[model samples]
Target: MSIIVRDFQPADAEAAAETKRAAIPYLVLTPELVAWQVTHAPGNQRHRLLVAEVDGQVVGSASTGIFAESSKPGQAFVNLSVAPDARGRGAGTALLTTAEGYLTGLGASTAYAWVLDDEASTGFAQRHGYQRSRSSYFSRLDLAAIALPSLPPLPEGARLRTAADFADDPRPLYDLDVEAAADEPGDVDSDAMNYEDWLALYWHRPDLDRDLTSVVVMDGMAVAFSVAQTDRRGRYWSGMTGTRRAYRNRGLAKQAKADSLRRARLAGCSEAFTGNDAENAPMLAINGWFGYQVAAREWRYLRNLTD
Candidate 1:
């Protein structure tokens, strides 16, 4: 069977979402979110989504874009996923070729991809000229079957709130995110510095669950938060859990995550997922404390396109 790779059409959203979910079950992907991402991407991102088809059936999907928020220049990323049954049919190769060409044309000197931490996946990346880099872990909690610890009583000057509480003014939360993101472990070090961009790319996203997003207020300041994303099918995702620098080591991040998970469980969510850089010990420990076990691991791979 011949495999064809082409730009993704609006009609392929459901199939693309299915392909992605089949490849990485813990990710928060839905048809609507996919469509929103393609139609609403920021100008700097130069985002493009592609799909691999075989005999009129879409079997793989790929997303490529410049790392607009990266401090480094000429950095781009391509993430591709092929359905298990569709592997080894040239779909992956075709998709990668299309993605790399797209990035190269956009002046990207380097391309990054995340491959599952397994022999076959690693070998594939290596064969394609990508070198292993940092790794990360995907963790999941059975919100319905596992017991979540009761949120500890707040300190004298702290209380919990939801993102909805900031509807009138989200600048405080955006500032807190920018500060917290500076310390996050990643190959690229960049802060979400632009409020308008952050509002367009994150706060107003279709998948964000404002009511379920938990925030910790210390003396009326939003010091910590756990952003939540949920699909209608009962899967909840922790988009980001962060605590400001001054509030570190105080279990405030845990409190925020716990509160968010509790809210998700009460809202009938069955499974909860989150990811962490392998070296993020504090967050890893907190996830462990929440009974979230590592379900999968992925290693970032980089290819120097300039060479």
Candidate 2:
């Protein structure tokens, strides 16, 4: 069967999401979120979601985009996923090749991808001229079954607030995210953070549950926050958890995450999932404190488009 790779259409949302779920089960993915990503992607990103099909059945997909948020130009990303049953049908190769072409067409000089820490996947990446870099871990917490840690009392001047409190203006939360993200360990350091992009990428996400997102406000300003992204299926994803730079080391991050988890559990979310860069030991320790168990690991891989 020949593989046909083409741009993803709106009707392919379900199929693409299913393929991604099969390839990365720990990821909290939904069709609506998949479609939203494609439509809401910032113009500078030059985002394209490609799908590979055999006999008219979508079996693989790739999300390729320029790194618009990075101060460094010519950087891009490509994440590929294939249905389990379609692994050996050349779908992966087709999608990867097509995605690389697409990225280069957008003037990308470098492309980064996440390859599952498995022999086949890593081998494929290496065979395609990709070099391994740092890794990231995915963890899952069974909110329905785990005993969430009892949060410590907030220190003076600190109070818990839901993200809903910022419904009128989320600029403070955006500021918190930018500061926290700067310290996040990753290959590409994002030095450019924009408010409009933030609103589109995170605030407007259909899955973001503002009521379940916890914010630690100190002196009437957001000092720490945990963003909760979930769907109707009782599953929750920790979109992000961070404490503003000046507010670090005060356990506000833990408090914010704990509050979010507690509320998520109470809301009937069965499980919670999150990802952390392997070098982010503090966040890992915090998640460990919450009894989050490691589920999977993926290695970062990079390819030089000019090579």
Candidate 3:
């Protein structure tokens, strides 16, 4: 079977989404999200989604781009995934080769990819000359079967709301996300404060579950929020959970996450997943308290493009 890599076409969206979901079950993804990403990826990001086809069927995909918002310039990313049944074929290598060339052409000096902590997966990266760096864990909880903790009563002057409550103006949410994103421990820091950009990519994202997303309101402002996303199958994921700097040290992030998870369970979600940097002790503690256990680990692998 000949494996060929090519740019994503509209007709390939569903197959690409399916390939990704099959390869990485923890992520919340859909065809619409794939299409939107191809269209609206920031100009500087040099984003390109590639698919690998074997005998006219798509079996693998890669999301490649320059990390435009990272504080460190010249950093790029390429994450490739192949359907389990399609794994031993050369699709993964084909996809990675195409992605690396694309990012290098866009002036990226360093390329990074997340490698699953498995023998075969790690071996692939090592063979490709990628060196491992920090690791992160994926955790899941039985949302429908697990008992949720009683939500602690909101402090006086504080209340709970949803992202929909800020439809008229989501600037406060944007500000909170920017602050929290910067604090997130990662090789690259993201600055996602652009309102129009956020609305187009995040607010309007097809997978974003607005109703289940919980926000803590203080003085009628969004101080802390847990962004939620769900797939067509009702699998819920915590896209992000963050609190403003002034609101840190309070249990607000935990509260928002718990509230969202409870709502997801009520809505018939069977499983919920989230990821945390190994260094993020607070978030890990919160997930552990909610019965989330480590499902898998992925390490960041980096290689200098020029080398």
Worst 10 residues of 1 by lDDT: 188-197
Per-residue lDDT of 1-307 in model 3, one digit per residue for the tens? Answer: 7888999999999999988888888877889889889998777677899999999999999999977667677899999999989998789889998899888888899999998898888899999989999999999998877887775777788888998888788888887788888899998878634666667657888888888999999976788999999985778888899998888888898889988888887887899999899999989998999899899999999998998
Lowest summed lDDT across 10 adjacent residues in model 3 is found at 192-201
Error of 2 at 78 (Å): 0.5
Ranking by lDDT: 2, 1, 3
Counting clashing residue pairs in each candidate, in order, gives 0, 0, 0
Q: Give the TM-score of candidate 1.
A: 0.97
Candidate 2 TM-score, true structure as reference: 0.99
Candidate No. with top lDDT: 2
Summarize candidate 1's per-residue lDDT along 1-307 as a digit string, tens digits.
Answer: 8899998899999999999999888898789999899988888889999999999999999999988777678999999999989988789999999999999999999999999988877888999999999999999999999988776687778899999999999999998898998899999776534787788788988999999999999976899999999996799999999999998878898999989999999999999999999999989999999999999999999999988
Give each model's whole-structure lDDT.
0.91, 0.92, 0.87
What digit string (tens of lDDT, one per residue) describes model 2 on residues 147-196? 88786699998999999999999999999899999899999987786998
- Give all candidate RMSDs, comma-separated: 1.1, 0.8, 1.4
List ranges where model 1 is wrong by over 4 Å: none
Clashing pairs in 1: none
